[model samples]
Target chain A: MSVIILAVFAAVMILLLVGLTRALKSPSTGFARSFAVVAMVLLPSVWLLAMLVYADSEMKKVSFCTSCHEMKPYGESLHVDDDESLSASHYQNNRVDKTKACYVCHTEPGLLGYMDAKLRGLHDVRVHYFGKAPEELELVAPYDNAVCLKCHGEAKSFLEGGGHQYPDTLIDALKAGEMSCLDCHDLAHHLED
Target chain B: MVSPFQLFPTGPEATTRVLKRGVVAQILGILVLAGALFTKMPLLMVVIIPVGALLIALGILAWVWAVVWADAG
Candidate 1:
């Protein structure tokens, strides 16, 4: 997909260059004027839109998130040898798609959640470049149980687990958001402070 | 009696000026877009891409304006 976008961009750029040169050389020519309009206006608009789509897809990758220096520790933590680390366990065990591990866990479940995640990404970019990056990364809000339940809620292991069964209302509380999944399974990332 | 200039200014000079401005803007936009695409960095994605697109949009508008309001000849 990215390769295709790059190819299209290159083609448009070549066409644009040709059009501009011709138009500038002979502004009186009708063919040059028409070709210039198509090259400059139509081709570029389409290419820009395609680039946007490519960027959106690329941003979902784990590599993209870890590209920033501050995020390197978090990315490394995913590969930590500890089974107790939530991120590491999920990543190593293939619980989530490794390529999009960051996005899958961080983003909420619906369209609004997806948009919110993208907005937060923009904020992260702003802070990363314009503002001072904090020494420690933290979530803007408390981690929601809903994000966890989206996957584990229906699992038989989760439903019939002895620990959860011991306290019957525990599952209910977790479902109702009264209790957080992180309350017990808090080893989200084993970052070295 | 409505003058031709009053109805639609068909000056070749004005057309050339607008076309030049549009072409310059388009070139700048394409360069910026290419740079962003090459790097594929978050900063480029967040800041540069939109700015480049905006420049192109403005350029296109200018080109259209030149074509519609100014003399091609």
Candidate 2:
């Protein structure tokens, strides 16, 4: 009986081994296959989350608005300029978080907006790589009505500075075809001396 | 019982390898790139680690194909 039991135990272990191999084998496939499927499912989620967080800001907040690398220096200028300067309008406002990052204000909302921003970004990258951008990049923030409407479109009173000190003439002018917010609020934060 | 490992003769094999490893390697590469994006791993995509791995797998397949199906007849 002991001899038969030993044989049976060996047979069971062999059967388990064979079962695992058979399950793993897909003609030539292996256990490595499952890992790929899992990885593919995960990457886009992180990218999407990053986009959603940054999307809340206005479109002009894109780093390219004030300049590529120039914007950081401009943002740093705010701390030096202090709140007293007219340059400190929306940026250094007492209640608002002034240290918000570059993309927070520049990019748009949702996946399509991110794609749009990235497409524009490709152009900027090409320009930068080819040495087309000037040493001091232009402050061409496209403060269109759609951009301002992101924060103020719903409230008619907010557009008139009822509860908000933020500029709304931008939305009004954009609607009226007069001008845009970037015409004056041009720099990333504000320009230095 | 015949040894399963010896199912094929040890003589010269065919020289016409089909390059299926390229397909596997390509898929693994895309998954790795996706993983890098997911995990916030820096220099993963920039270094083209995914493509590099795929290339290595493809190279291995090419070598195997050469050994197995190398028109040496």
Candidate 3:
């Protein structure tokens, strides 16, 4: 079954290549242009299905998030966040597990969200290649604390005095500065240590 | 001589080429998933492999489809 699928896939690739050479001028209207038609319809669907499956199985693992060495600071900070270290309060206290609990905020929804992330990654890659990113690690800019608020919302008991305690009357404090969740807490998940 | 269809007297065009690649890629992606089920490899890596393949296919398809769709327009 697998072999047949692979062969059919290869055949389709060959057909598309041949089709491209033939239909350079007009593609859609052509009856032989079924390749374009099928591709157009199937790509997103496949991607969505794959993501759903992958996410269901492994995407939610905290270990996956802090795999990168750069994420160590983020990871360590999550453990260190407690009343003893209110000064270092980053991700809402012991309530949220730092290791496997970032996607709850960082991840957005839909195609544009995915594309935007990919583009950002491409930029990060380019920066790393060209030595433009930071010598050390840094926060994902525009890391609006708003995402933190998405879940925390100053509603959780543990967050009564949590670092991310959405400041009331900060109507000015928020606009006055570039404060974000990472400003205090270190990177949590996807650790490299 | 008459052909079954009046296919512009040549092989597929760029648009069709990309389309074919994408469909094949998606098909191969499915196969990868199946193979993963039968293999001992890490499910994470196995799953990820197909994602890359799928993206390549979709990216190419989008590129080509825009060309053909535009030309047709």
Candidate 4:
């Protein structure tokens, strides 16, 4: 898919060059004029917009995020078979879509959450390039409980689950930032001990 | 009345300069786009996308500007 996108971009570049050349050489009419006016100017703008949309969607895939060298461990953690491993359990048990696992779990709620995630992704890219890639990467902040509750909050299994049986205290603790689900459960990435 | 679309300016030298600038912009736009896509660097992408588009836009503008002032020759 990435290859296809690259090829399409390359083709557009070629077309732009060809059209520009034709306009420069020929008289201001006929094939040269029409191709220059339509193909050179308009087609590229449309093609670029399409490319941006395609790239954005492709970048959401788990494969895309894990492509970064520093992220491979986290990606590997998802495949861990141990039930205690939060991300592994979610992935192995089919709780999350494997293809979009990164985005599914990481993208926050509300209107700008996805955009915010994308911006953070860009920051990661910048860090990877400009800054020293961390020997051990950790989340800048702790994970939000709301992310977990976003799904499990309403589920009967979660509501009746052992630790969650006390809805008021547990839910309040989880929400008020007094407790983290990870305090008991294993961390999601399982990158380190 | 002058047609909106024209190609070669009466001063061929100036027309050549525009073409040269257009070509350079096109190359830069391609470089930015290809780098963003091949590397799949998200931060690089966020920066390059708008810049690449601007380069392409400039390339087109250079071509159009050249044509608008161009002679029928």
For every model in order, the TM-score on chain A comes to: 0.80, 0.48, 0.43, 0.73
lDDT of 4: 0.72
Per-prediction TM-score of chain B?
0.75, 0.36, 0.43, 0.74
Per-residue CA lDDT of candidate 2, range A151-179, in tens? Answer: 55666675555433445455556556486
> Among all windows of ten consecutive residues in candidate 2 chain A, which has the lowest summed lDDT?
A35-44
Per residue, candidate 1 scores C-alpha lDDT tens digits across A41-136 of 888788777766766777899999999999999999998899999999999999999999999999988898899898999999999899999777
Worst 10 residues of 1 chain A by lDDT: A47-56
Q: Which order, best to worst by lDDT?
A: 1, 4, 3, 2
Please give the TM-score that candidate 3 achieves against the real structure.
0.44
Model 1 ranges off by over 4 Å: A1-4, A21-37, A153-172, B1-16, B68-73
Q: What CAPRI-style quality would you assign to candidate 2? A: incorrect
**Residue-wise C-alpha lDDT for candidate 4, range A30-149, written one tens digit per residue:** 786676665456756765676577667778888888888788888898887677788888988989888888888887776687788877887787888788877877776688777788
Candidate with top DockQ is 1
For B1-73, candidate 1 gives per-residue lDDT tens digits of 9755477555666666777788788878877776665675898777777888888987898777677656532
The interface root-mean-square deviation of each model, in the order shown, is 2.1, 13.9, 7.4, 3.0
Model 3 lDDT, residue A113, Cα: 54
Give the alpha carbon lDDT tens digit for every residue of B1-73 in model 2: 9864355333222221223343344344434433332322122322344354454355345434433333221
Model 3, B1-67: lDDT tens per residue?
8653344322335444555465455555544544433333233443455575565456555545555
Q: For candidate 1, what is the DockQ-based docking class?
A: acceptable
- RMSD per candidate (Å) reads 4.1, 13.9, 9.4, 5.5
**Please, what is the whole-model Cα lDDT of each candidate in the order they appear?**
0.82, 0.42, 0.48, 0.72
